[model samples]
Each structure stands twice: as structure tokens, then as C-alpha cells.
Target: MSHTPAPSRYDRQPYRRSGRSGLLLPTLSLGLWHNFGDVDRHDTAREMLLGAFDRGITHFDLANNYGPPPGSAEVTMGRVLREDLAAYRDELIISTKAGYRMNPGPYGEWGSRKYLLASLDASLKRLGLPYVDIFYSHRPDPDTPLEETMGALDQAVRSGRALYVGLSNYSAAQTREASAILRRLGTPCVIHQPRYSMLDRHVEGGLLDVLAEEGIGCIAFSPLAQGLLTEKYLASIPADSRAAKGGFLKPTDITPGRLAALRGLKELADARGQTLAQLALSWVLRQPVMTSILVGASRLAQIDDALGIIAAAPLNDAELAAIDAALALENATT
Candidate 1:
């Protein structure tokens, strides 16, 4: 069956220009890091993809090793692209990354030129795309030269495998160095994807400043701290929750103090008529350089909740101070 996108899709969502670039991304971009794997329900994944686009989420983020089996997420997205989103390809900003273990060989992973280029080919094949909008380094490889990694990124654009290139999980220093190299190569780094949230503020230490200086937009992943910022873990971790799954977020991560902090945040969110998740997202968006937030959703309702935050008022000085106090209380209690 052909999919008919909502006519009002562009009316509700706001777009932000990716620093110094002609690209404009929706405030909320859907990430396929989870819940679109072969093990997941195809129907649900299909619904979420189409639903997100219908709500004006034009950007979709993916990586070479996103699924449990690695690369399966791209395969799932490939199906959606072919079956449902083929007509809207021009309206979409699909991106994929390489820099993790996808195979067991000398060139299977890392930022090497050979690996990065090969991974892009494989990702393009899996995603069934001639080229991706943005191809990322995924993570910095300490063992590889930055030039080799970034050169491959430049080559990706020049070779027509990617329209633009980006970096993810790189330190402030690494990002600076990589950006310089890409600039010299004449393919300026357009965006940086970092793990950021109220709970994880490592980006503030220097990364954000580097991005601002380099004219690279930032799209934060895990803005809800991998679900910790939500009310789902305020009391106890549900069996179906990602924390219980024991990968990135562990059950032991939810301590008594953390729960207390979540409760405090929940109270603040209630006062604003927002969910804990929305409040967390709002806090992350407070940064002027934060171009977008990459969100993952297992269900349609989660997407709805995230989209709702776009209209919520920005955090004022008092609210920001209160959030800091709530977080500080966690440190005191911990």
C-alpha cells in the first residue's frame, strides 16, 4: 500500500539551520539506534517511521552497528524507505555512521580510511540509498590518524556516497583537530553528535564551545539520559525498560538518590504541565547551539510526547536554578 503523508506535516514543527550550513533540520530527529532491529516488530517500526515524518521529523539517524546484531537497523530502515518513504526521499535527511565493530577483522572497525569507506558502501547497500545526507565517524579511533578518518569523510562527499560529513563521540580536542583537517580538505564539518542530557553534561566541559567556534551544529543523543530523565524509573525499573535490558543503562544505575532527583524533576514538570521527559528535553534545548535532539521511540506516544516539548516555554532563570538544586541534592544524598 502506498503511504500518504499528512499534508500539515510541515506546519507544526520548527527547523533549525545546522551551523554555517544550508541544511535545516527539524528540532526533533528520529534515531534508529534501537527498536528498529530485526528482532523488533516491523509493524511498530514502520508506524514510528511514517508517524515521525508525518509530524515533520525529516531527519533520521542511523549507524553501521546500531542493532543488536549490528547493521540490522539499517536493513529495517531500508525496508521502510523502499515501501513507505520512497516518495518523500527529497524531504528526508537520512544519515548513517561508521566507526564501531561490525565485523571481526583488521579493518572491521575504527576510523581508518579503508574501514570508513567500506562501511559507507555497506551502509548504503543496507539502507538502499545512493548516498546518505550525513555520514559520521561514529567515534574517534585512538589507534588511527585523524587525517585518515577525516580524509575518508571528505572522500565520502567527493565520491558521492554522502552529501555531508560529521563526527560523533569525539572529544573537544579531537573535534577541533578533525574540523581543521576537514576544513583544509574543503569539506567543512557540518554537525557533531554528542551524548548530552541534564544527567550527562560532559559536552559543556568544552565540546559545545569547540562546536560553536568551529561553526558545527550539535544534535544531542540521549537527551533524556537513556530514559533516566523520565518518570519510568522514578519508583522502580520496569521489566520491559531499557535499564532492565542491561546494556548502556543498568538497573544499578538507578540509585535511591537518582530516584529522589527524578521525583523532584517530575514535580517541576507537573507545574509546567509537561512530562518528566519533556522537561529534560526542554532543558537540553536551552542551549543556543543545540540544533536538534535525536530521540528514540519504541511507541508512537513517546514521539508525540517529545514533539509536544517544542511549544513549551523555555526554562527561565529560576527554573534552571531549581533544576541545578535538584541535581545537587542527588550528589548530597548519594
Candidate 2:
């Protein structure tokens, strides 16, 4: 079946400028890190993509090694584009990264020019696009010089493989240096992708400050903290939950103290007439440096719940204080 995007898609959602760049990204971006893979149903993936676009999510983030087998998410996205979104190609912000391992070998991973450029080509082929809107160096490679990595990003744009370049999982110092190199090369780092949430506040110590000072956009991945911030693990881990599946998140990660914090946060969310996920997302976006939040959905309803935060009110000072208080308990136990 052919899919048609709704005409009223862009009416409600607002787009934020990516740092000092000319590119504008929807406040909510969809990530194809989990469900859009060969192991998942194609029709359901297609529905999630279409549903996201219908709700005004124009940015779709992917990585070279997202799938369990690797690169399958991009193939799934390619099919969705060919089947449904080809006509609206110019209206979307498609992004992919290459710094993680895509194949087994020395040249398979890292920020080396060889790996970054070759990975971009592979990603483009899988995505069925001539160029990605934003190409990211998925993580900083300590083994490679910063100049070499930044130069690869610069060359990616210069060669017309990517329009803009970004850095992911880089520390504040690394981002500052990378941004300087990209700036000197005349392709300023447009954004930074980091794992940030109430549970993970490493970025707040200095990375957020660096982004603010350098005028770089910040898009948080894992804003839901691997479903720990959601209602899924309130009582017991669902059989289908990520924690139960045991990869990135484990059953042991959720202790009684963390659950207590979640319960407290959930009550606050309920008082505010929003879900815990919504509250967590809103908290991440409260920072001005946050250009958007990347969320992964197993179902269309999850996407809907995430997009619903766009219309919800921002968290005020009192609410923030309450959240910090609840988090303080989790921290104390840790």
C-alpha cells in the first residue's frame, strides 16, 4: 500500500534553528535505532515513519551500526522513502553517522578519514539518498587526531555527501576543539548529539556550556533513559521491556531507590497532567541549547505521546525543583 503524508503536518509543530546554522529541525526527531530493522515488521516501521511525519517530525536520525546486524535500519528507511516519502524529500532533515564499527577490521570504525568517508558512502547507499542533511562523526576517536576527524567531516560537506556536520558523544573539550577545527575549515559544527537525561547528567557539567558558548545545537538521544523514565518499569519490568531484553539496560540497573525516584517523578507528572515520559522530555528541552530530542518508537502510539509534548506547557521553576529533589534521592542512594 502507498502512504500519503497528511497536509496539516507542519501546522502545529515548530522548527528550531540548528545552532547558528541555516538548517531548521523539528523539535522532535525520530531515531531509527531500534524498530526499523530487518527483525521488525516492515509495515509497522512504515506506519511509524508516516505517523511521525504526519505529526511534523521531519528529522529522522540513523547510524551505520544501529541494527543488530548493522545497517538494516537505513535499508528500512530507504524502503519507506521509496514507498511513501519520495515526493517530500526536500522537506525532511535526514541524518546518519559513521564512527562506530560497521564491519570487522581496523578501517571499519573510528574518526579516520578513510572510515568516515567510506561509511558515509555506505550510509547514503542504504538510505537511497545522494546526500544526507547532516552527517555526524558518531563518537570521538582518541586514536585519531582531531584535525583528521574534523577534516573528514569538512570533506564530507565539501564533496557534497553531507550538507552539515555534527559530533556525537564528544566531551566538552573535544567538542570545543572539534568545533574550532570545523570553523577554521569553514564548515562550523552545527550540532552535537549526546546521551542526556535526568539519570545521565554528564553533559550538564560542561558540555551544555560549551555548546551554548560555541553556538552549537544540542540534540539529546536516550532522553527517556532507556525506558527507566517511563511508566513501563513502575511496578515490574514488562516482559517486552528493554531492561528485560538485557543489552544496554539491565534488570539490575533499576534498583529500589531509582524506582522510588521514578514514582516520585510520576506523581509530579500526574499532577501536571502529563506522562512521565513527557515530563522527562520536557526537562531535556528546557535548556535553550537543546535544539531537539531524538526518540525511538516501537509503535505509532509512542511517537504520538512524544510529539504531544510539543503542545504541552514547559516545566516551571517549581516543577524543576521537584524533579531535582526526586532525582537527589536516586543520587543519594547511588
Candidate 3:
């Protein structure tokens, strides 16, 4: 490994402290939920990751089952880590989750002490690192006792496998339950990664409130709503869009009414001299606890475009009202 980093391969983006925590994550963090896997272009992944780092995106998020074949994304990240960012490991915040399926067996998935602890160790080995900046429980497992699940995360921190622990896709109430356990165990329950976008106001159902009340940080994932909130879907699902993909996004989900709302949102974006993707990201990031907006990029340009959103001004009263009207239309049919 080189003694120094590769001549600053990334630009520095704005940084915000995740809640009141000492950690300052980049305003826009990268997630390996899709397209960083086995079949996706390796150069694209490398360039995007490098571009993000050059732009000061220090935090990178991943899960055990992120790759198309499962675990390939982490392997690829590991390769990148060794090849490019090895010297700068101390400055990066790399995180991985384990609640989702990684194997077929009954104990292969879910939030158990056994599964999370084992999964983190596997992730660490694949990343070629002694420890991760943060480790998250991918989801709430109703079958497993929250205590046991929470204990798993607590163990990760105490065992020196992960510096801090986080929760993902967990509801406000469930977050409290798990958070309570982790806090009692003396583990730093630092953040939560949740899906939040204009099309998905599910967080308003109390998740954000709980995070706020607890002083825990939150990174809103899929801030583009899987690209549906972007201008790319205004006309029709482009063959290259997520909608065009056979899974995750369905054609039926993009109804005429939804398209109209999208159009209105796009129009709003155009009026502001910004793209819909930027607008959607700025909207959700307006919240205080909105520590970082987790984004996925298939190209360096897309990542740059998202980074430009940091310059976006806060939405005013009129913009908020207009957005509410658009959401009303969506509620009627959604």
C-alpha cells in the first residue's frame, strides 16, 4: 500500500454532523444497493466511487446481499479499498448491513446475535479491514426478540468489529425498542438509514419523529425514489431507467396520475433551474435530522449532479404548499 492517498482522487463536498454526534458525514453518501454488483460495469463502479471520494463523500453504505449474486458488491468494494483508498482508510466511513438474506438457511438472515455477529465478521473479511465505521441491522425482524437483535449490534461495537451501530428500514417504534437496548448495553447507536422521498412520505408516519426525539442520526436512502422522482421518468420509463429493470420497480406503479404529479414536480424543478433529482433530494434534506441523503449512481455524471444539490436552497412556504398539492394528487390514487 502506498504511504499516501492517490493525489486526492475526489473533491470535498459539504459535511454535516449526523445529529449531535461527533461524526460528520458528507451531505451525500453513496450506497451499493444496486449497480455496483457483479454484472454492472466495473469501471463505472470504480469511477463513481472515486468521483464521490474526490468530491468528499466519505461515507459508503452497503449490505450483505447488495450484489446481483449476493456479496459481490462488498467484494468489489474491498478490491477498490485495497487498490485505491487503502492509505486513506482512517478518513472513510464504510458501513455494511446484515439483516437481509445472505444464504438460504433459516439462520442465514434476520436480526439475531448469531447472524449479525457472524455477518459483520464476514463483511470485515471481504472488505479487508479490521473494522467498519458503522454496522446496521438491515431490517426489523418480528420473529427475533428485539433484545437479541439489539444485542447483536451491541456486540459488534464491543467486539471491536464496528465502531458504531445503526439501524435500517426500522419503524419509529421499532427503532426505539432497538435503540433502547443498544443504549443500555453501552453501544453507540449512532444512525438509521431509511427510504424517504417525495413519492414516499412513509417516514412522516413517525419514524422521523422518533429519530428526532432520540437524537439519533438518519440518512434518507433512495432520495431519488429509485429514479422515479427524476426527469428521466416524465415521458416513459427509459430502457436504462430502474423502471425498465424487471424487478424492484413495476410499470403499473407509474400510472398516468403519477406521471402528471411527476410532470408537475419536474416543472417545479425546471422553474428553479434545477433537475427533478436535485429538487427531490433537497426537499427531503430540509429536515433537521436529515443527516445525509444516500444516493446511488450508475455514472460519474449522475453522482456529480446529485452533489450539486448541496447548493440547493431550502424550499420556501409557497414551494412547500405546491408540493403538498402534488402529494394530495398522489394520495388520491397511490
Candidate 4:
């Protein structure tokens, strides 16, 4: 099938500057952390990628170890890029991360200079790109010196392998330290990717403040909390659900208390004329520091649902109060 990108793609979506940088990323970005691997059909992945681009989502996030077997997601993405999105490559913001285990050995993982540099090379090879728009450290390595890790990120940019550098899963203090090092190295950290959702508010405790102070952009991953914030898990976990499969989101994580909270949030979502997932995404985007929300989709409909968040009105003060009250109830029960 021939795929022509929507002519009005830019008109429908909103773009925000990434921190203090001149780069403007779409308000919503698609992540290839799930459902774009060798285990999945290539045609479906192609559809989702084209669908996202058509809907004005210019950013596509991936990691070195996104597939179940690891590295296959990038392979899948590479194919799609060549077959479908090659013409519009200049308009896209492609990002990939390193630091997790990609192969067996002392040098296969972490934030060491060797690991990061090698991993970026391997990621570029898999992605079939000369340079990714943003390359991230993926996570902090307590075993390695922060200087080494930050230096590797700086090198990635200086070497022209990545246009910008970012960090993920770093705490507030860690971000402050890393950003300072990157700044000194003459490669300022452009973005920070953290897990932010209604249920996961760790970023709010201090990370948001740190990013704001440092003028670093924030694009939150797991914005739907691995689909927990969605209505799919409201009544019961489907057999095909991520929780049922017992990987990152275990069935036990869905306790009775969580169910009750989901129910309350669902009512609120209904009242707001949105789905719980949209509400969760909207809530995260309400923060001015948030440049984008990274969402994963298993199907075209999921992508559509996530894109709807951009059009939804920001949650009002009364709605925010009600959400806080519901969360308080959830905390009491848990």
C-alpha cells in the first residue's frame, strides 16, 4: 500500500521547544518500547508508524533493548523508516537510548564510556541512520563514575552520532550533577525522560523542579503507566494484557485498592468526556516543563486514543481537586 503523509499534519498538532533548545518536538511522541518487535507483524507496525506521522506525531522514541528478544524493535523501525518514512526523515525527531544490557559481557551495558559509545554505534547500525536526533544514557550507572557517563553522552553529540543528549531514570540530584557536567563539556543536556503518570508521581517530588531550573526538556515515558491508567484494566485484566503476561506490570500490581481508584478515575473521565488514559496524559502535559508525553500503542486505535489527548482541554481546578481527592482515597485503601 502507498502511504502519503497527511498534508495538514503540521496544522493539527502542537509543537513545544525542548527545554531551552531550539528543537521543537511534538506534544505527543510515539514509543517503540512495545508492540514493534519481531514477535509482532511488520505490517501492523508500519501502519502505526505511518498513522502516528499522519496524525502529526513527529517524534518516535526507541531504545537499544526494546524488543522482547532485544534490538528487534529497532530492526523493525529501520524497515519501516526505509519503506515508509524515508522521504520525511528530515521532519522527524528520531531518538534511541543505550545503557541497558544489549549483549552478554562486561562491556554490554551501563554508562561506561566504552559501553555507551559502542551501544550508540550498534543502535545507529540497527536504526539505519547516520545520527539520531537525541541519544540518551537510558539510566544512571551507580557502578560507573558520573563523569564517564556524561562524557560519553557529550562524545555522542560531539562525534556527530547524535544531534543532542538526554538522560533517563535519573533522580533530581543526579540530573543536576549530570546536567552540570554536560554543560561544562560544551554539550548541554537537552532532555530528560522519566516515568510520569497519575500513579507514578516521583518526578513531581523534585525532578520537575530540577529540570525547570536547569532548563532541560522533559518527555515522560510510561505516561499511561503501562496501560494501568487506561480503562482496559478497570474491570479485570484481559488475558492478553501486559499485567497478565507478568513482565514489567505484574498481575499483583493491580490490587483491589488500585481497581477502586481506577473506577473513581473512570467516573471522572466520563464526566470530562475523556478516557482515563487521555486524562492521565493530559494531567502529565499540564506541567509546563513537560515537552511531550511518550506513549506506546499496540494498535491503531490506541494511537488514535492517545492523539486525542492533544485536543482535550486542560483539566480544570475543580477536576484537579477531585482527582487529588480520589487519589487520597486510593492511598488510604492501599
Candidate 5:
């Protein structure tokens, strides 16, 4: 499909600086973790990509193992780049990650220098780009030494295959050590991706502090908690919902207490003139360390809803307290 992005693509939406880096990312980014794979409709994926760009979402996040079959999301993105967004390449911040199981054999996955570098090469091939704006180590490899993993990330930048390096799913201590290693190597870990949402506040425990202290940007993924934060599960889970599909989010995970808590959150969202998802997005971004929130969408409307938070007012102290009270009530009930 021929595409012309909106003339004022960067007008209203805001960009946040990634850590102390000079890079500025749109406050909201699109993640291709789901619904952009080979199993999904090509037209829909293409439409969402173009529509998002038209709405000023410049960053597109992907991982080597994002697709149901693994690596297909990048192929889909590559096709979009080649067919539609090639001329606007420099206007985009395309990122992808390694350190997940992408294939068989020991060298096919993990944080080994061999796996990390090799994965970047393959990701570059699939993305159809000489280099990605940010390349991440998807997770910390237990067996692989941290030095080895960070070394590969350093190599990625030095080789000009990636402009900057990032860490994902790393703990607070791990992040601190990794940041030091990257800094020593002159790469200075620009960003860290962690699963963060109202439903999941694990990052707040210490990871956010580490990122803040290290001056590394935080781009939160799963900000909707795999769609649980939305109204999609207020009453019943949709037939096509991720929970119904029995993967990362299971139907059993949505209990009555959780539903009740979400309902309370919905009330707050309604009062604030935003959707529950928007409220959730705004909540995670309340942290000063947050550079961006990665939102995964199955349709154009979902993209619009996530973008809605960009204009909505940030949650005030009273609203934040109410959210906490509701969550605490849920925990007590459960």
C-alpha cells in the first residue's frame, strides 16, 4: 500500500530523552510482540504501522522471538519498511532484541557473544536495515557471564550494527553492573526495558531506582499487562483475548477480586475521561525515570486509545491514592 504520513506527524505527541543519551523517543512506542506475526493478517499489521506513524509514534519495538513462530514480526516490519516507510527511515526509531530462544541448538539463543552477535546479524537481515536504532539483550542469561553479554552489546555499537544498546528483564543489581560495564566500554546502556504496568509494579521495587541512578532510560513493556489493564476483561474475557489463548496471560489469572479491582480502576478512568488502558499507561509514565511506554495493539483503535493518554492529565495524588486503595482492597479480598 502506498503511504503518506501525516504532515504534522511530530506536532502534538511528546518525546522523552532516553536516559542521558541525546536520543529522544516518542512518549509512546509500538511493540510488535503480538499481532504483527505471520499468524496475523498482513493488511492489518501494515495498516497499524502506517496509522501509528501517521499519529506520530516513531518508535517500533520488536524482539527476535516476538512472533508465535519466532522472528516473523521482524519480517513483517521489514516488509512494511520496504514497501511503505523506506523514505522516512531516518524518522523512525526501530529497535529489536536478542537473548531469547529463537531457534534450536545452544548457539541459537541466550547471551553468548556468539548468540548475541549472530542474532543481531540475523535480526538486521530480517529487519532489512543495516542497523537498528537500539539493539537489546532481551534478558539476562543465567549461564552466560554478564561480562560476555555486555561485551556483545558493546560490540554491537562499535561494529555500527546498532546505534545504541539496551538491557531488558534485568534486575536492579544486574542493571547497575551491566550499566557500569557498558559505560566502561563507552556504550553507556541508553535504555532498559522491563515489564511494567499498574497490574505489575515489580520494576518499582528497585529497577527504576537503578536506572535513575545510572542515568539509563526506562521504556516499559507490557504497560497494559498483556491487555489485562484494559476494559476487555472487566466483565468477561473476549474469545480472542490473550488470556483465552492460554499463553503469558491465562483466564485463570483473572479472578473475581482482580476483576473488582479493575472495575474500580475503570471508574477512576471514567471520571478522568480516559479508558482504563489509558489510565494504566499514564500511571506507569508517572515515574520520572520513564522515557516511554511500549504499547502492543491488535487494531488501529487500540493504537488510538493508547495515544489518548498522551493528552490526558497525569494522575494526581488523590487519584493515585484511590488506585492504591482499590488495589489494596483487592489484595485484602483475595
Candidate 6:
């Protein structure tokens, strides 16, 4: 008789190819952008991560400066990976960045070779991994030459510290230059992580084109506009919302006009029998160039909601037209 292994809980979420790469990423990726910091409960962070993976979130986004105390998120993730997720590391796509300030000296941050190499080492130590699947430059450094940063990223790949190299928060033109440098260094940039949402469509300005021309994947962050795209603020900011916590989401960003527009969006989402957060996420992953939507969840249930959005399917022309109209008004006023 043939033996059948028990089904893993992660058999649900759908996966899509990340750009033109050989790897396939889940449509929804969990990000440790906020609340997974030093101040948050370790158990809660682990639960959120475990719940996400169980629901098929194979990709996890983090940066060296992710914590309030800096590097705490990675340290926390390291514990979870060791305690519960170690055996499944091959199934995980872990990414970390290093362009931000991590130390006091000039060489301690930015795109210089010294900072990049050293920062990747520190991140690896905190992550407790031999190599991360993807290593990002975090952001563009104006003062530092692009070659230096790209070169360090190449070294990270060549030395087997990171398997793939990516750039984050870089402009369309900047990405063009960075790609050239990476190509010369023999490390082709695989992806570009950018902040994109219904409200923040700046990447649509031109960056998506660069990503396509270079065959790089686009992983969108803040697809829900830092919770502004969710029904959580349909009435008013709740006590536990990011705005209330004075974190990444700001109070001023939630103007009366924006709220009214969101009410319309909330109604639209209700008509589809889904939450505004789900719809907002659905909108981002709709694009062909989009590899994944990087989202943050404070609770396991929130992760459940995110995973539910992956199989929502394509939006019809009518829905797209309505979204375009509503978002046009919002953008005009912004």
C-alpha cells in the first residue's frame, strides 16, 4: 500500500512566477515592516509569521533596520526560524536590506562597499541563516556612487551570502543605472521593491517600465496604503490602528475628503463581499509585472484575511472603471 503524507497547512495560497525568474513567489507576502519590532511580543510575531507560512506566504520581507532598536525584527525572526521554521527553510524566501543607518560612522551605512558587506554579515548573523534568498540595497544613496552599492550586492551573491540581489526605493532612472552596474559585476538585479498602492501610484509613473525592460520583478509594499485602504478607517481610526499608535500611518494623511472616497471604496468592496483591504491587495497583484504584495499583519487573523485575497481572481472592466473613477477624484484632490 502507498503511504500518503499529511497535507501541510500551506497548500492553499496560490503562487506566481516572480518576473521572468525561475522562482515562484506567493501572490501575498508577509512583511515585518512594523509592530514586529523590539517592543512587540515575540510570541505574537512568531504566531503572525507561522500563521502566514501555514497559509502559504512563502516570502518574508525584512531589513537590517526593521526594529525600533534596530535589527530586533531579524533577531526575532531568527528565533522563530530556528524554533519552528528551520526544517522548512528551503521553502522560504527570506529577504533583508542594508542601505539605511545601522551604525554611527560614515562607513556604517549607505551604499559603500564596506557598509554593504558588513551590514549583510550582521544581518546574516541576526537572521541565523547561511544565506538569504534575496538581499536588497534598501534605498538609493545620493552621496555614494551607484557602482559601489551594486558591487557590494554582487559580492554578496558571488560569495554565497545571498542568492539573489535586489534594489528597493529606487527611481526609474536610478534603477537603470543600478542595473548596469550589477550586470557589469555579474549579478543581475532580480527584483525591485517599491511602495505602491491605490493612493500611491507613483511607481506607475515609470518604474514599472524599467522593471520590465530589465526583466526584474516588482514586489509592492504598502499595497493597502498603510491601512488607509482598509475598512478599519471607514468610520474613524480605531484605538489600535497604526494611526492611533503614531507609527507609519499618519493622522493628517487621513483627510475628510480621503475618508469620503474610502467610504465609496468600502461600499464597492462590500458589493464584492470582501473587505477593502482584500480589494486593495487584489488591485496590486492584478498587474503582470507585480511579483508579490508585501503586507504587515498585527494578528494571525489578519494574515488569514491576506491569504484569502490571493485567489480572488481578476477584476472585471466595470470594477476597474469604477476604481479608476474613484481613485481619480482622490488623486486630483491630493
Best by TM-score: 1
Assess every candidate by TM-score.
Answer: 0.99, 0.98, 0.95, 0.98, 0.98, 0.95
Runs in model 6 with CA error above 4 Å?
1-6, 331-334
Writing each residue's lDDT as its tens digit, candidate 3 over 267-302 gives 788888889899898898898898898999888898
Cα misplacement distance, residue 209 of candidate 2 (Å): 0.8
Q: What shift in Å separates residue 58 of candidate 1 from its native position after superposition?
A: 0.4
Q: All candidates' lDDT scores?
A: 0.93, 0.93, 0.85, 0.91, 0.92, 0.86
Q: Clashes in each model (backbone N, CA, C under 3 Å)?
A: 0, 0, 6, 0, 0, 0
Q: Which portions of model 2 show Cα errors greater than 4 Å?
A: 332-334
- Give the residue spans of candidate 3 off by over 4 A: 1-11, 331-334
Local accuracy of candidate 1 as per-residue lDDT tens digits, 75-173: 999999999889889999999999989889899998999999999999999999999999999999999989899999999999999999999999999
Q: Which candidate is the best by lDDT?
A: 1
Measured on C-alpha atoms, candidate 5 has an lDDT of 0.92
Error in Å for residue 174 of model 4? 0.6
Ranking by lDDT: 1, 2, 5, 4, 6, 3
Cand. 3 Cα-lDDT: 0.85
What local lDDT does model 3 show for residue 220? Answer: 91
In candidate 6, what are the lDDT values of residues 284-316, reduced to their tens digit?
887889988898888898888877775676788
Give residue 15's error in model 3 in angstroms: 1.3
Cα RMSD, each candidate: 0.7, 1.0, 2.0, 1.1, 0.9, 3.1
Scored by Cα lDDT, where does model 2 land? 0.93
Candidate 6: pairs in clash: none
TM-score of 2: 0.98
For 132-163, candidate 4 gives per-residue lDDT tens digits of 99999999999999999999999998899999
